[model samples]
Target: MDCGIILPSVSPNSNYFSVHASPRSPCIMVRCQQKEGQVKNNHHYNELPLLKRKRPTMINIPVDRSLENNNIMNTSRVRVQEVEVEEDGYGVYSKKGISRTRLEDRYSANFASDAHGKSKQALFGIFDGHGGAKAAEFAAAKLGNIILDYLRRGDKSMIEENIKNGYLAADEEFLKGNATGGVCCVTALVQHGSLIVSNVGDCRAVISKAGVAEPLTNDHNPSREDEKLRIESKGGYVDCCNGVWRIQGSLAVSRAIGDQHLKQWVTAEPDTQILTIKPDFQFLILASDGLWNKVSNQEAVDVIQPFFTAGSNKPELKNACRKLVELSISRGSNDDTSVMVVQLDKFAH
Candidate 1:
């Protein structure tokens, strides 16, 4: 993908500032102040007055007219630098499905400052598209923003409200499409010293805390008594197939993003939970059923923890994600595969 950076234009009558991003480039901004004095050359120059030997005060003045018109007088420059990494440092890859017409998986991560100076918020997500890739893409692009917006708007005190609003917004966007609807989503927002997780459908989020793997969110499916009751109360019947409950012999999950026909019975809202972040919070793995089907949560955590303990960074996390997808394909998981991994320490400043 081609990426571009945008900068705002500078004003002529005010102090100008500009920021540029690149491996070796320095971010800088220049400020020019007005100059006053007589000058022989067109180029602006400052003059220093002589002082008395005993005690005196000195003054400086500009000597050029053109420099004043061009706003080059008494110019001051500031440079801000950012850490640079190699292109391969991100470590991401994709593969084609055996029978699927198109790739239906997506993953993304973002890092920014959190409440603590040495801590940062790391966002990781996995979107599994069912009927089409539109809903998945829509959720990948907009859900993060909606959640961040809610947090920035002072709604962090209510985690459930923030997650529900974000999921609903993404669902509204997907409804504009004409294709069948189905998307399983899982997200993790790592803040100061906590991990806030939310999920819909079977896509899972598991964390390795103190070498013990634990689920952060409940999976919404018709197999559960509560889920079955909720669906049946809406005049929807659950068909048991292979020990799993299916909605009207169609979907396996009772909750998801799209699936408009089953919207009345299922909900787009996800179950949200917040956990205290501890030193033992080693890593987090988020993946669709393609990977979860072949590997259990604890197994998934076990397979990736070695690399993380060996000092793997963002690149390692990306590699872990791709490896899960590959494992799914090798294990005869014909479904489209999506996987994402997030390392807490890598995000900390």
Candidate 2:
């Protein structure tokens, strides 16, 4: 338990100093002479005292090597695995009535060190799926790897290209497996105080800076004029069959991955943007439409502000995701809910 460096030294002619002994304790005390740099242990001497009359100085004492190693191992083993999930029918049907599934998949990686040995880089992502979990799982497993690989390849402008390529690749893989689900994806890579974000579908990415929520990616929906124009221009029309424009009356989102039917008319090219993380940039929020459908970006940021500002004890990011999902359910959002909150300071090495 006493795992530390202790220095013990005595003069050639020292008076008798009593040392205490514990019952059957496994303790080793190493004594070293400053001039000789030699080490020795006195098994019989339970306590070694330092006298003011001694001219010899002990630079360092070797404590229990095993104890010190154990302490270091324990410290290095500390890590955080933050994740959560929830699902509810909300007075709709029987046990098999609503097949509502909430999938929250996230990935966060930070460089242990930088090239100049001063700054570090961090990467994060959140994938929220609606129709099925395959898309979300796919994005969670592969997007971060793709982005990191691109960065490692030393392509300065490859972030956006890599994101677009990753989305398209996931779409292809999903279609090959006969999975018909669609997902809203968002990714952020932070390097050298800059952030590059890419998003598709309704899952949103919002940056909270200076107490204001600024959206990083626009929602690709039928209601947006830009999306509407893009969809219509590609020979696609958004028809309001159930009070909302649906692609060909089947898909709700005008843009998404793995919607083969929709993909025929609409592609999965994500909207990408690069941002600078100034002192004002506090955090970023990424979540599926389930959270955004019931809560605005500003409202969601407000709901999770306390967690981010209250230091590092709480699992703010995961808790924020859970809270957002709970709020969506309370607000009668039947769709699956997922949220991801990332703090800039947490990634600042």
Provide the clashing-pair count of each candidate structure.
1, 1
How well does candidate 2 score on lDDT at residue 222? 81
lDDT of 2 by residue, 1-349 (tens): 5333234434444432233223343433333333343223333344344322223332322111221101101111222122342111000000000234222333333343567765476556666655655666666665566656656664676667876776676677777877767667777777777788888777778888876899998887787888778788888777788698777777777667677667865567889998777888877876667678889888887877776677754443545666766777778776555566666765544
Number of the top TM-score candidate: 1
- Largest lDDT belongs to which candidate? 1
Quickly count the clashes in candidate 1: 1
RMSD (Cα, Å) of model 1 = 19.8
Q: Could you tell me every candidate's TM-score relative to the true structure?
A: 0.68, 0.65
Model 1 Cα lDDT, one tens digit per residue, 119-148:
356666777777766667667666777777
Local lDDT at 297 for model 2: 81
Where does candidate 1 clash, by residue pair? 181-259
Per-residue error (Å), model 1, residue 59: 70
What lDDT would each prediction earn against the true structure?
0.64, 0.59
